[model samples]
Target: MPEFDDLRDEPFEPEVLSSEIAFAGAVWDVRDDRVRYGDGEIRRQYVAHTGAVAILALDADGRVLLIQQYRHPIRHRDWELPAGLLDVAGEEPVEAARRELAEEADLVAAHWEPLVSSWTTPGGNDEAIHVFLATGISTAPAAHAREDEEADIRVEWVPLDAAVRAVLDGRMRNGILSIGVLAAAQRLRDRG
Candidate 1:
């Protein structure tokens, strides 16, 4: 049997980092996650949520599509698959996945398969990034993005072996996107 990471009920100890959204004037609370590990002391943890999406797009020729975007937080451009946060209050996780797909790729997938769900930075944020397999895509104009955002996202098709090679070669930067793409590619190869 394949082994999976097991989580158990633990404790939370928090220290407030921020109490406001500085730009939007919305009240927001940010805290540090502390878990009991050794000798019942506190260990810093990542707080994650179930509201993020990682879309794996496979085109008509079975080529995997990837995006290159400038992430200011990291100070440079990184090659990654399409992904975004599912921040809408009343929408399901998959709903955010579809919306992100349309906005980022400007394409709609006729078929979608939920592949994997994971946390991006477990030592800080508790964000769960739901990865999906998207096929049978058609292109259109982008639907949405942040007003001040200028994501010069380059969409290009990469062969399966080449994509995986890039990941192994340290070219793929996003952790979750790398795992999502490799997993989806493996499944596709198995099916073929």
Candidate 2:
């Protein structure tokens, strides 16, 4: 007999009854899963989410621009690159990137590189995130931020080697940043 985690012999099938926004400011959904793992079993699941986007702003000094913000879920300040949601209606991805760069870091760039695209968490809701590299940057002014954000916005000019090391050391937790850094390095190496 194969070991099964089902201690309770509950016999049931999953059926999505109704997915309704019991509250505001969230994507609410109810889903059902009919398991066919050598047997007929089912389960119901509910999920809700708010999607977002992330932008990687690269400068001429071979350093990546990042933002230090307090993430409520983690309950600590995280050093992540500038990012925002594709929340604007009828806005292109590039436009969303530019807006996020200006809004979060007050920086602008002359060159835009199509780096990569990702779904933050595809297993649940439809939350997709787009990543880009903005090179040849210059200083500007931040237009938007939360009113109560305990933010100390400092732009760290980290070299590629240092960035990779940060990832190894567990300092850089943002997956997009690591991906961006590796891509930038490859781009540089290819130029040689």
Candidate 3:
């Protein structure tokens, strides 16, 4: 009998028979791969992502920073945490989170601690996102220029509990936002 005391994801890599790009986009690409599995072979396709980072910026008053941006796929301008892709070569995830916080919210944080890491859609994509808890926040020295959907981003600060409520009520639908807020809230409870 195997012990069931600990539950965690185990990494496994199967033998790849063939792999190729099924679709190439500006940011991500769809990868088609044939792998040997259980005495047989299977073909699968998924988005090959560069990964991303999200920051849950919390102020002294317990308010969380959020930004509303237009997401074309969903066709809704949904509220989301400060997040961006890890597209820059040689840049660390924490640095990417810091840059995103500054760029999206025009803010800087004195303290940053990792909250959680998740795979957005393990079945459809290989996108892994790292969420960080940012406290001791202040305005950035300079604001970054925005373009496209980010040009009209709306920034707001909501109480941490209220943000969690929004997530539970389905008013907030961004996966990263939902995960970050809930994880931050749980972290607070654990600390208290």
Using Cα atoms with residue i matched to residue i, what is each candidate's TM-score against the true structure? 0.76, 0.72, 0.96
Where model 2 places Cα greater than 4 Å from the true spot, the runs are 1-23, 26-51, 141-146
Tens digit of per-residue lDDT, candidate 3, span 66-138: 9998999999999999999999999999999999999998999999999999999999999999999999999
Worst 10 residues of 2 by lDDT: 37-46
Q: Which stretches of candidate 3 lie over 4 Å from their true place?
A: 1-5
Structure candidate 2, residue pairs in collision: none
Clashes of each: 12, 0, 0
On lDDT, the stronger of 1 and 3 is 3
Candidate 2 at 111: error in angstroms? 1.1
Show the lowest summed lDDT stretch of 10 residues, model 1: 20-29
CA error at residue 39 for candidate 3, angstroms: 2.2
Model 1 TM: 0.76
Give per-model CA RMSD: 4.7, 8.5, 1.7
Candidate 3 — what's its lDDT?
0.96
